[model samples]
Target: MKTVALVYSQHTAQTAELGGRIAAAWGSEVVYLDPDTTRLEDWMKYERFILGTPTYFDGELPDSWDEFLPELEDADLSGKKVAVYGLGDQQHYPVSFADGVGLLASYMEELGATIVGETSTEGYSYEHSVAERDGRFLGLVLDPTNQPELTDQRLAAWLEQLKVAFAG
Candidate 1:
């Protein structure tokens, strides 16, 4: 089975860029889709998934991701490996910072996938987040709006962690 990196965003390319970087780092196929684009199928062919999206409208995922989520929910992803990465303006939406990541992680969890890449909440300055569970972000969280300089470092670290997790 193969690994897939998928992403959807409406406004900026940051989310797509991050997803591409992840796919490159992992040497996997990266797929970018809009809400109205062709739907992804054959879930059972991919043993692992790395997903990315941007938070929208007060802690919600982009419309494309929201719409695509139902398909994922319907898939039998049990025993698969999954991880999420998301972009959010922590300073602006502290209450819902990276909530999209949390939403994706929760869905994967519910589908019985082994979620990987849980990140520490130490560097981020958020009041509350759906992404936080057990004092960690549900997955990777990037804030290009607030801390663009750290994106590379954070991505590198998270990718390293994912490599280890994927190997185990």
Candidate 2:
């Protein structure tokens, strides 16, 4: 199995919690990296990555992600595999739910990374989201504040999908 890095902001409680669950489910092959402390060079060590973020203030990326943007942009992720997951409250922020996932995935794609692990939009009640592309979410979207019950199942399925995508 390829080494997978699960990068996320430790500042956000929900995002951090979800990242932990994902890393745990992914077993020993996955390592957790906090965007706040992880160096830009460290990101290049992993060929496959799972990025997590929490949407803040009208679909904006969190402070940690904002600060890390320059390093992420500078990194050459060509031919790398990346999957994004985001935390949002569909009930409260339906208009821009999980927008952070879409934003991050777009940036990675622009850097020549292959974004994978798209998930269906079913079972989610959201007015609209940038994360949705052709009826599927760009990656996993978890709402721990609202739809907490589905998080486990969603993570399980997304990890399985990542295993296949990373293998290829």
Candidate 3:
């Protein structure tokens, strides 16, 4: 089985929801880390990462993730595979508000994580399974209105990719 570290800065319910999906579908153990915990081993042991969070203001980066990124400046994840996802208010903010995934992608780059690009707009997967599939064709449209349920197929495929990358 694979092990994935789902890191996020959000309410416990949200974090748990996402982590639960990953654990169940991917046959991977899941770890939920909030904004305050240390990420020292996260980079080494976990071959892949799923970063999640909510949008604050107009696509502005959350302080916790911001701080966390700099903290990882010394960590080496250059060859690891990483993907990002986020939940946010679509009506109240700019489209960029949902861009935490991108910021996290960039942050991983700083740490040497070879990003595979952002994952599907999990928000959509929670609700529209069809939209999630459409994402496979459209490449990541980032639907803020969509609520996605981390499906088995989706999680399994993602895990398989990371497993191959890590197998070296």
Report lDDT (CA) for all predictions: 0.78, 0.91, 0.55
Per-residue accuracy of model 1 over 5-122 as CA lDDT, tens digit each: 4555545488877766776676634444454353546445566677777888798877777677777766767778888888889899989988989988998888889899999988
Say which prediction, candidate 1 or candidate 2, comes out ahead on TM-score.
2
Ranking by lDDT: 2, 1, 3
Winning model by TM-score: 2
Q: Estimate each model's TM-score.
A: 0.87, 0.95, 0.64
Q: Mark the 10 consecutive residues where model 1 has the least summed lDDT.
A: 29-38
Per-residue lDDT tens digits of candidate 3, residues 1-168?
456676766553554465566556556366666656656765466776666655566665677777777667778786677766555544554445455655666667777777653344544323222112235311122332443443445555655665565445
* TM-score for predicted model 1 compared with the true structure: 0.87
Model 3, residue 131: C-alpha shift (Å): 17
Task: List the candidate 3 regions with Cα displacement exceeding 4 Å.
Answer: 10-15, 117-168
List ranges where model 1 is wrong by over 4 Å: 9-12, 28-40
